[model samples]
Target: MKVEIWSDVMCPFCYIGKNNFEKALEDLPFKDEIEVEWKSFQLDPTLDPDQTKTTFEYFREKKGFPEAQAKQMIGQVSQMGIKSGIKFNFDKALITNTFSAHKLLHLAKKYKKANEMEEALFIAHFIEGKNVGHIDTLVAIAGSLGINTDEARQVLTSEEFNDEVKNDFSEAGSHGISGVPFFILNGKYSVSGAQPVEFFANALQQTYEETVIPLKNISGGDNSCDADGCSI
Candidate 1:
């Protein structure tokens, strides 16, 4: 079964959800048969790539959130991150456009390293407080993932994988997904938000059972048909 996940690097819940989903997969007996693909989604596409602001400030200024409310809301999310084993430093997080980052992810996808790229980006933005919108930052991240630095730079410097990122956005819209951390199992079942581990496990188990059929050995003992002849 294939699991497609739509998420943004800047979204805290997305990272938490990823951790939970992976944990769920770990407990499954057929985990090796599962394939996971990470899709791109921008929570705020209109954000300026050069913009430099803390997440707290961004929420306070752009979202019309009061200072106290912003801190409180961010604090709540931080607590949630703790439970999911993620340490979100909203205070140090930089607010910038994720377009280039999404493009980088597309580049990584070609190497089957999209999941690693996604995890790196989440850590960069939410933990290390790095500027994901910057090409140099992206290049360094790509290097760390064992992707060719020059090729990654070339891709980021140009419009490579732009359509792939846009297609992910378009597909998400078509699916009526307006949020990050949305999961689609086998293109049939959908699980939205940072749901609990059990939610993902159940979805995975159900989807696996429905999609993967086991072959039954119907041959009776000493009465099975062979390539030469049937033993009746």
Candidate 2:
């Protein structure tokens, strides 16, 4: 009933995976009982904050792909995104370190809006062409979402939630998750990458079959509980 997802703000696939997961949940029979936990994952901790190139140029340089090829890849991803009701201008994205952003996400969890903040940050970076790595810009986005801007500004300047974010990082490492959008369901099964909705649904069903349905068929080991009574 619990799903933990490890993702990065700067990663495009993380956004795509979010869409896929949302779509999958809509069709899940027990959607109302599901709990979603967002874990912190940084794709590039050493990203230079002063880099002025657009996101596509950075990808082109870092990935060694020509500008034309970069644009083509962006076009492909954008088309895929359109199918899922997301619009991403990946070619012109700006890259930066997401550690601080992860810190804010951790802070947002206390307010029970971590999921919204996560999705907002993704949209800010990929769609609106905002510099999500900048604290001031981040505060503005958080404020627009009705989050306390002053508190967010203070947290951005201070070390608050730093350790919590780091703990999520450590947790991901302990789980052997090495990439963004890695998913763990019920702490028993894991599916890596931005998989399709059917893949997640099938994985859940398969886990239930292998782990839950059989137990339901077990004979009278605890008939008292089923009878809603206790023997005194």
Q: lDDT winner among the candidates?
A: 1
Candidate 2 residue-wise lDDT, 80-191, digit = tens: 6787688887655777777878988987898898899999999888988788879998898778778899999999999999999899989978876667677777776776
Task: Give the poorly placed runs of model 2, Cα more than 4 Å off.
Answer: 50-52, 208-232
lDDT score, residue 155, model 2? 93
**Can you write out model 1's per-residue Cα lDDT over 41-99, one digit (the tens) per residue?**
88888789988788767777777778897777677777878988998988789989999
RMSD of each: 14.2, 12.0
Cα error of candidate 2 at position 216, Å: 22
Clashing pairs in 2: 55-93
What's the true lDDT of residue 18 in model 2? 88
- lDDT for 110 in candidate 1 is 94
Which candidate gets the maximum TM-score versus the true structure? 1
Clash count per candidate: 0, 1
Return the clash pairs for model 1, or none.
none
